[model samples]
Target: MSKVKGHKSVIFDLRLSTFDACLLMQEKPKVSVTRTRRDSAAKEFSFTADSIPAGGLKDVRAKAWDAFTKFSMPITTDEAWRRTDLRLLPASDFKIPKEGAFEDLPVVPESLLKPLTGEQHGGQITLLPGGSRVDLDPDLVSKGVIFTDIRTAEREHTELLNKLIGTIVKPEDGKFAALASALAGNGVLLYVPKNVQVETPLHSVLWGPGTDLAHFSHLIVYVEDGASVTYVHEAASPNETGHAMHAGIVEIHVGKDANLRFVELQSWGRHVWNFSHERARVERGGNLDWIFGAVGSRLTKNFSDLDLAGEGSVGRMSGFYFTDGTQHLDHDTQQNHLAPHTTSDLLFKGALKGKSRSVWQGMIYVAPGAQKTDGYQANRNLILDEQARADSIPGLEILADDVRCTHGATVGKFEKEPLFYLKSLGIAQAEAERLVVEGFFDPIMQRIPFEGVRERFQQAIQDKLSVDK
Candidate 1:
């Protein structure tokens, strides 16, 4: 793979023996490893490359090894990650699961895996750490569409992979992003040939085994001119308590007149610190839609960036988040209008209960000469308890005098009137709260493209609102 300008490149030769040994390593709390200042009092934890091997096998694995060692990881104190306590993560204890990590882990709960595994989800592929081969749908390959694991892509589509990976989202952008680049391992790459359209959505899963082991993966998607596709990714950890580092990147390119819908769900275990960057570039007349959901993790930092480079292009961004039990979720979003007559819309809703916290920072930029641009952004949050907290910052910058730009945000508890009305109808207080929460989340669900996924998300929100734990 080619290196970026002014950057040195390193390789990780991932081998079975080396990865297995690392996975079995005992958890050793090294909050000091991520410490930014030597004299600081706060505790933090980061993946230690010295504990992982430098070379063994696999070219892509070697690149990951190089990243873990060269890239600067973040300490918990980093402003973006300060709210999510990393000290609780057992990063120091994780090891790569043996060959059985894929099958050994509990069958992914049907509630979560059903939407992704079926033939309707477009195509489904699974990746295993330390060298796992993936099988793709032959029908797609017959259509000249390339959907495979990143490792295979590197070997077969090296030039395309290098041009797209690590370019859209840089690890140096933030602590979480940087860590993902440094530790990237197995991921997926989907390429749609020019003018071809895939009606169904594509699904891929990234599974990291062993306790306290670092899992880094990258996704690179290219939609050639006049092509159409949708992709979904799910990240989760079955083991309850371990320091599993999940850092991943997703880069999408929408060619002229192409259409792409992307969905991502983050459900890393409570003990995991999931950091990711999702971005896309829209060519002239292309269309892009993004649907994101963040539910589980001790702390998560996700950025959604879209660039409208083509005139008359359209983009939509919608997000849903539910945080509880001291969890923290941070989101940074940008809607950039660089061409004339482009339209963009953004809506994000979050509910924080228990001691959980969430932050939404969204911005819109309309460049000069980008007249007739229509841009809108809105964020709403419902705080379910006194201990719950939410922060929303929505802003806009317009250089074109003839542009339509608007942004708004709101943070409040369930409206007392609404709750009372539900209770008066004979609904219990808990049930009343659940109904109100659903009302808050329902509008956003309308934007999801997949009915099956939307149903699951609605049920997830209902469960979160009804349960007190």
Candidate 2:
């Protein structure tokens, strides 16, 4: 709707100090289109227990570890991390998952484990703090579809795994990414061959461990030309006795004329901290649809990107997040158009209650030769309490004169007229409020195709509202 001043104006809604916000933006927000280059090559790195080792990709693990060792944890001084405060985090206390028996792990809830369909759900992958299990459809496997755990895939399909990992969301791209790349031992890898379409959606769940623990995870999906697939990722945690951390990475590669639908649900405990990076690249004529739901987490800082690299490609991103209590969530999103006739649209909405706070910073960049591009991005926030806070920043940079790009952000609350109308229908005040909030998120919730996943989100929303059973 409205364009802020390049990248500077929208970034003003920061929780960091004024001086820090200015330092991070430095006039226009700096965006990394390709691999990030920092001072890390000179540092020495050693392999940990969880370091994945493959035939040809051995060097990748060592290199990523070296970067992580050399890289310093982000602080308020860094521009990308200026708005996110981690002063209380015990960064030095994190340890790589050790090799041992994982059978004694805690039991996860059944609601989180069950899939919507019996076997129609293509597959289900369960990842823990130290172990993972993948069960795919045997019928699909006979047709050349590869869906398995990342470590196993490394041993089997080393060539394909090496080619895609770090190619899109490179290890050196950011601090969190480097950490996940260097040490994450458990992950999922799904590859759909060319011209093959799998109607059923695959699912993955990351269940948290006990207190004061740290886990690194990864999920990589590669869809070949003319192939189509859908994936559902759910992150849930049990109540913790102390602070916990879950740092993860998600990489998606869509080949020419392919299609992929991705869904991610984040619902951790109040003492859990989540930091992750996700990116998707669509080739010529490819299509990518992403749906993200964040209904839990004590504190979260996520950086997600979309790069439309091929002409005639299409990408859409839709997300919803609700923050209550003392929760704090910050998201920095980027959308880049590098080729002609590519289209991208992003819509993210959030609702804050109690003393919770949330910030969203988004940017859209179009390259010089990217003509006839249609791109739009927006973030809308609903603040339900006077103590709650929500900050939205949206911007665009167009080097191509023929491109149509627009961005806007809005911060508001439930209109009194709507509430009054619902109350006039004999609805209780609490029910009326919950109804209005659900209606607000209905648009984005409808984008999720799976019936089971949608119902799970609905239950989470109801829980946040503290609705009666």
Candidate 3:
């Protein structure tokens, strides 16, 4: 694949033999081809409202399935999708496993089981293919905190789930979002009641199914007014030769005067295609701190957004990604200021090696009458090889005359001055490069709240660098 300079356009070659050309000339060519028509694998996969089992969410699934049937997957013509191409994706090869098909759970990686803070988690949930395990501190549960699987919540906390589910991220958001809503059967829910403060962090791990299968997971975090909490989520899978897919969603609600810190780590197998829609809404006087780490997957497209919907609300986002081999990772982010006196800040940093490519598109939007709004966004990328490529686009749209908004983006290679300085100190060339890479990601690493997590990311970076050497 190749990209044009100063534009986010990819050049694809279409090869047709003489017979193919003759057949095309015999019929009127269509202007566009939908995803189902282009992908033979997708034609084999079919779904309807009746396909969903009877449950509290059956209606929700039905509504989403209807929407999914009508909507088509994104194409390069769409403004938001112009930078990425989906023609090479094997959409039909991975089928969603039937309920109760995965009775034997896969072993959880030791790295995932290790504590991120070197202390006990207030609650923990591990989601397998068709089963889940949950653990919560009795003290927190007694205080009205609920941390469990979605199935249990549907049976015990029906009113709460019905009220909050599909509220933050609706099916209308995108095509994959509609599919996820209609098919997702495994998920986690974390609810903190009003005025409750949880000092320990909650953790969740989602392990993908084996080859030729797909896993759709959802996460909901609700912090009521005057409540505070921290949560961490991780998604990963073992390496496999066959294709797989992960379509997921995350919705967060921070109520008035509430505080929440959320961290997400994505490390899918090399044969996986990942797609997700994640969003958070901060109400009046609420605060949200979010961090995202991306390190694996054959191809990924993710959308992350934060809405400052009430006066005095604050939102901050820190993101970091590393790509190698032929991996492609694209992240589209937005920070919207919808109320006066609201503030939002975002920074995304990435490093690319081998033939890998990374794309980052960020925007800061200020709605009308959003006076005293402050918004800022920046993206920086480091290129470690001549064959690697990185694209950064930053934008701003301000309807309010009294708001302040700024955006910046940069893509560059390692500065010779730093390498020379390190070499002058007798540091080996490989070691110097590794140090530079770590320094490039230090700003985002500092924003992580836990020491163990930081060290884990550091180790991951080292491993990537070593492989390159």
Candidate 4:
């Protein structure tokens, strides 16, 4: 029951009376509704003390609340958040899914229940509405491995959780992360003890029902010294479902001489607004590899941040995205080299069709003391139609003299000659287009470490390319 001022936002509904609604501002303070029309009126609501608490970050929440008291809506017009349709995301309209909704839910998708076929993939584990609790094989656990839910792990393994959480992706860094920390209900916790080598991959899935609800989730992983692990985070909404929101945060830590490979896939309902933030840190002699396949969702925003924190650290990331219909997908990534002899490389490619739009903005920064740093970034896009659009922004910032950095971006179309040649071979246009797209994405897909995920990536692309009557 604090006073949070309203701002000059657009009016999507104008038939109600005097605006007096009270809305949650994610991590910000209480937000009040403003008069948009004589008939438009806002309604007031309250949060009970018994509501699911968000205390893991009480101090940070308080500081954010204090800042919210000082700063109100009609936020400073920052370019980073320009594409985000906050008008559709008014906090008042957002709420946690009712517990009863999950009581009698249908069985999980069969695809999820089937055991993973790839070599060393994590087996089936606990799946929930907003979070997951995965039980790693006891054999692996005996070798100093740790895998479980974030909440339980935080309670039982405080030191491991404390040392990794919020360190890679700080909650205060952005509104999405802040909101996720303030409202997230579930998450995954994974730890690989020092010097252990587990060549298998851990997998977790997040499924949301189409109920116009929101589920903020988090994922934290730590690989101790000389250890190795791979992780996959998959998200999807059931077919034909409508209007849902999924906001999530993921953090991965690779300690000295350790290696980590991470993969992420997102396919949500058409009405869902998907916002996710992923961050990773690499220590001395550590190596980090990342792969992402983005599909589905009406509106989506993602950020991937990598920090090379120790000498000789290395990070490599690659992704492929397919967008169709009126969907809007945006990705922003950063690579920060903070130590000497650190290196990082990134490549992202996307294809847009059916009047959709996609944007890619990536940056690489080499600190003043990060001598002998090597960094490279690239973004490439293929536009299939005149109405579909793509945007790319790749930049580099260097304060070190002994660094080698390079950045490039390109947005183009599939070569007509290749298609024509395929047509002459008696191939239909649809099939020909599929060939071109598959080839365009193959470079990155071939590099994916797991065959099962790579096949999923291919299937996603094929699904997007299939034209509907």
- On TM-score, the leading prediction is 3
After superposing candidate 2 on the true structure, give the runs of residues whose Cα lies further than 4 Å from its correct spot.
Answer: 3-57, 100-102, 116-119, 467-469
Worst 10 residues of 2 by lDDT: 36-45
Give the worst 10-residue stretch by lDDT in candidate 3: 1-10
Off by over 4 Å in 1: 1-100, 116-119, 131-135
Candidate of highest lDDT: 3
Residue-by-residue lDDT tens digits, candidate 2, 412-448:
9768888899899999988888888888888777776
lDDT of 1 by residue, 302-381 (tens): 87889998999999998999988788898878899999999999999999889888888777877778778888888899
- Better lDDT candidate (2, 3): 3
- In model 4, the Cα lDDT at residue 270 comes to 73
TM-score between candidate 4 and the true structure = 0.84
- Compute each candidate's TM-score over C-alphas: 0.82, 0.88, 0.90, 0.84
Per-residue lDDT tens digits for candidate 3, residues 214-269, read 78888999999999999989999987888888989999999999999998999898
RMSD to truth, every model? 11.0, 6.3, 7.4, 10.5
All models: lDDT?
0.73, 0.79, 0.84, 0.72
Please report how far candidate 2 places residue 335 from its true position, in Å.
Answer: 0.6
What does the lDDT read for residue 66 in candidate 1?
A: 57
